[model samples]
Target: MNQHRKPRAQSAFTQRAVRVGLFAAGAAGIAGAVPAQAATGLPQHSAIAVDQTFSRADFVHHTQARDSFTVRQFGTVNAATARNQANAVGVGCSVDDHCRSVALSFQIVTMAGEHTHLNAINRGDAVNEHCDGCQTLAGAYQFVVSTPRPFTLDKGSQQKLADIHRRLDALTRSTLPATDLKTRADALAAEVNKVLADAVAKAPKGAERPTVTLHRHLDGWPAH
Candidate 1:
């Protein structure tokens, strides 16, 4: 079966939208406890939750306890885009032996300039949509590689990881003066698509088969 591949720019919306499915990779091993200073902060209640239609693995992301931003960290997502990515090549952190537990959490402070909603099915139907300002980001980005256990990516897939990571790290937060619902939703919306893309790219394709689908509710799911 020939699955149509989308252009890089075209996947923007789809990329961000599919984030809901990312939790499916829960079986993959993860890393360890990070310093309070390393986590990315935003605002929200409960860890991220999956729509349940995405996959079988139940993964949730929590907020609240996090490291205060102080001192420079290495290989972090740039503050510019309000995005972050972690690469744990081959060795899954959560599934790996002796690997400590790490956290993956963030809040959608702003929507891409595209039209979207707080609870959007796709970037287009968002209650607050604004594609023009999709790149205008204004928020925080956080991802920490705990001590002892670090984040890695599949060697062959490292490049794919970097591609997605760069897109995530380069997200521009929403503007301050434009305190509007559409603008905020638009910015946050893009990220949703990005997450989906990540899940699609990471999914087990071929005979094993890769799965990709976005249902709803990725808020407050933790990776416990």
Candidate 2:
């Protein structure tokens, strides 16, 4: 009877150890699914450094808190067919390491001389829509051209942009609102898209449509 009881106790201990090992393995897998920054012992909130350039105009936008960020670009236009370029940069951290990436977007908004005709060129990747570790970032570009003209946006694009703008505008005016970084970033994206869509809609129709292009040098950034 003693020998039998001792064997039973040994078997129970072994089973308990196996169960513990399985639980640890499961916990590790869950951690692996999370962002590296969160897995590593890093502060939940830290200052994020941001910089942006639009059509050769340079600006810096940063936030000490990880809640939100905004960037605005404004410049003067003097040429008949002017080209615009913009890029936004930010740094993201993992558990023990950090990497820098940039978001790039561009569009051409112009008006013909002596004519009320407006023209714009829209490229697909006109904005950065994805940043792995970035909670939220917002940006805008407003150029003080010689004279601005009215432009029409595609029905689909126009409606989408308008919706986004309206939502953002409402949020901006709210006295007290509750939301997260992802929501704010999404609202900001709508504002940017509306600007571009409006430019495309108002773009003058002619055989000599100017060319618009976007050149990006960063990885893991999505086009809008």
Candidate 3:
């Protein structure tokens, strides 16, 4: 009985080994059947940049004897810029396996400057999306830096200037009668001149004016 049991055990072990070997051979065959391109996969990378600049100059001269003249100049500038850099890598997929990868980049910068005195520079990569193994991801990054001409003004004068800016914005957007809007805008212009004169007259003697630089950074996914 012991001898018979020994032979049965040996037979079972041999059969299991044969099954394993067959399975390995079949797996190798399937792997070999896969296209070389699919086995090595493909990688993609893209980069894009957009740059724009605008400049305008207007000169007006009028000579008249005993005549009152008023000149109003209005200008508007709108600009948009976007930079994108994307990279996608696929690490191969088996014949019986499904694998997908996606990479995307999107960027948009919009600015509306009234009176055309604003200078905007958009630089650097704004978005990067990475994915591996059927994963999906979206990302957006933005860096904004603003440098303005240095100026020294008292706190009161600063507040006045802020108020003037608000009023001007409102007047521009108002739906009131065209003549009324014009009148209000003209008044605000006069106020601006007066504020500038007062600021210059009351400036501190030998005041140390420091240049200010502003930096802002945004990172994450945006809805819509």
Candidate 4:
């Protein structure tokens, strides 16, 4: 009876050892499969709560803490067809190994300019750009060219611009998903298209129609 009992005890101990060994191997496999960052308890990508709720004070605080860039290309070009070109006019700034929000405002204001071409472009990857991973929070470009040459902006065009301005203001203040922001941006571009078309139609014949091309590119959003 003693011999049978000893053999049974040894068998149970062997089974337990096997189970422990299997568990250890499984744990090792799982650890090996994990990424290097995970192994080091570091996150590869930080999360951005696009649709998170925050107060106006919080928005102002974040905006003030980050970098801001404003540019105005104002003046009249006497030439019938004047051209103004700016590349990477305004950009954002990074901080604390992460990106911060930035505000970029660009305006082209002139009085009575005929056949002017305004090009304002902000490419995120400029050679001297400092905002490597910065996000654009508020951005706008106002192109106002008033001419006394019998060219008037119709009410419809004015309304479109107003609507775009309102939407842009809301976007600057609200927290929205990237996709949603992109949709709104596309809509704004569409409105701009209509305004341009209207301008062409209203311009007198044999005159160089004033043209303005504004391009703004920001991180986490499509180019506008």
Candidate 5:
């Protein structure tokens, strides 16, 4: 009985040794067979760049490089254009024969301005949360333009309505005075800066693409 037990013990030991050796060999083979491209610092897809200011003066996309980057920018061009329509409205309203025409310009401008301004703010908000032109996170504005524009306010025919309209109309106009357009512009610039955050991706980190840059140049506005 003792001899039979000894042989069984030796057989079990031999089996354990074979299993350990096989496991070691498999691990070594896997380690040695790793893709050489990954081992030598090469990425799968190339890199592209998109650089531009408020309006894209020049935008270029790049690929394959030692120190390469893809820069994306955002600007409120369409909303701004819609907001600027106020100037045409102002001129048209002033010339129209109807009394309500001229008065309506203020409302139109204010409402449009409010809408446009809101849109800009919304875009910025999207960037902060989503890190892109459109909202990436749960709560974000895809795009918005809220400008303050008043409605038709002509008093001679409708005295009560006109009086009430005047008081409420003030709300539609920008609180910023004529002396402060520049200040307001500065504020907008700052807000824009806040929205446009820089995205840095090393060789393997930034393929997801933080943001996409686009452009629409205004006719009169200076190129940002």
Candidate 6:
């Protein structure tokens, strides 16, 4: 009877050891899965840019005229495209109790990365009042431009959409202003409109084009 009890005790001990080994193996598999889960949840980065500009002008008397132009850009734009995106030219004159100021601001953003350079020129003398066929009297203007990276949307593309929204908000709130502010905002708007129209025309069928919205404010200029 004692020999029978010894064999039974040995059998029970072996069974308990096997159960413990199986539990440890299962916990190890779960630990390995944690990294794979984290990798799936990581956000994928994409390149995008949103550029906007605003211009203001004010004049007092024939001799004292002031013009200001402000340009702001957000997001990561390609260096080459941004370098040559916009060109602005202006001319003004003050002569014989007559003074005038004119400014033009232009900018473009394309699928191709491009740089935008702000150009401003002031010419006119009170004494000579020589008008070199220059025009004056321009008003404030505003422009909005966007360039989205190409992508294909799948059924489960919610994560991609969220990423785009995040980038848009970042660009909208944080704008880089140019050193000089003398470009006509309206002229810039017209240029951006043309760019958007061209983009719409060139888009592929079934492709989702970027959305644009305009916001105007009577409040003073925005802080840099």
Output the number of the lDDT-best candidate: 4
lDDT string, candidate 3, 79-141, tens digits: 112222222222323224422222222222211121112221221111212211221111112
Candidate 2 off by > 4 Å: 1-108, 113-157, 162-224
Which consecutive 10 residues in model 2 have the weakest lDDT in total?
2-11
In candidate 2, the residue pairs with backbone N, CA or C atoms under 3 Å apart (3 or more residues apart, or in different chains) clash, namely 118-204, 119-203, 119-204, 151-202, 152-201, 152-202, 153-201
In order, what is each prediction's RMSD in angstroms?
A: 21.1, 24.1, 33.5, 27.1, 32.5, 29.4
Model 4 lDDT on a 0 to 1 scale:
0.32
lDDT per residue for candidate 6 within 86-123, as digits (tens), equals 11112233233333333221222222112322121111
Give the CA lDDT, 0 to 100, for residue 128 in model 2.
22
Give residue 127's error in model 6 in angstroms. 20
The worst-scoring run of ten residues by lDDT in candidate 5 lies at 2-11
Q: Report residue 184 deviation for candidate 1 (angstroms).
A: 6.1
Worst 10 residues of 1 by lDDT: 122-131
TM-score, structure 3 vs. true: 0.25
Off by over 4 Å in 1: 1-174, 177-209, 213-224
Give TM-scores for every candidate, taking all chains together and pairing residue i with residue i: 0.20, 0.25, 0.25, 0.41, 0.19, 0.25
Candidate 1 per-residue lDDT over residues 36-102, each given as its tens digit: 2222222222122111011111123110111111111221122212222111111112322211111
Model 4 lDDT per residue over 75-130, tens place = 33322211111112123333433233433332333222343332222222211134
| Candidate 1 TM-score, C-alpha based | 0.20
Please give, for residues 96-215, the per-residue lDDT of candidate 5 as tens digits: 221110001111111111112111111110011111111011011111111122122123323542433353334223343222422333333333323332211111122122221221
Error of 1 at 180 (Å): 5.2
